[model samples]
Target: MSTLLLLCNQKTVSDTLTDVLRSVGHTVIVAEDVFSLRTKTAKEDPDAVIIDLPYVDALFEDIKRMSPRLPVLCWMQES
Candidate 1:
């Protein structure tokens, strides 16, 4: 029962991910932006982070700084 921090700005994507993760017994915390993401990351100390934001690289660096050992999974759109 690991807690996961989900950073997504899109409503549909966030909702879908939250539901799916919850169904699999993983606790999901959704953050729509970097501010919330940082706050939640500190408060929750989630096992892993799933990011689907506009600035992936920058966000990833920030997250790494906050929690170096924490696992991160990034989602990107192919264009």
Candidate 2:
């Protein structure tokens, strides 16, 4: 299984998703803020990433400045 890095601002959301991914056998690293997100991505180089889309544009801009090849999955809630 591939490692999954999750970037979310909500603690409960990050915890829940981390637990679920770990249960499914993927190593999970959850970051609750932008600083941690950058640090983790640099240190871990995860196979996949899941992020909440609230700050998608800003985040992607930062990500592009840093690493354009990184895989990102922006999560969206359906109303």
For candidate 1, list the clashing residue pairs, or say none: none
Model 1, residue 63: C-alpha shift (Å): 0.8
Model 2 lDDT, full chain set: 0.79
Q: After superposing candidate 1 on the true structure, give the runs of residues whose Cα lies further than 4 Å from its correct spot.
A: none
Highest lDDT, which number? 1
| Candidate 2 residue-wise lDDT, 33-75, digit = tens | 8888878877888886788857777776776567778888887
Q: For all candidates, what are the clash counts? A: 0, 0
Tens digits of lDDT, candidate 1, 1-79: 9999998878888999999999999999998789999899888999999998779899899889999999999988664
Per-model C-alpha lDDT, please?
0.91, 0.79
Give the CA lDDT, 0 to 100, for residue 36 in model 2.
81
TM-score of 2: 0.80
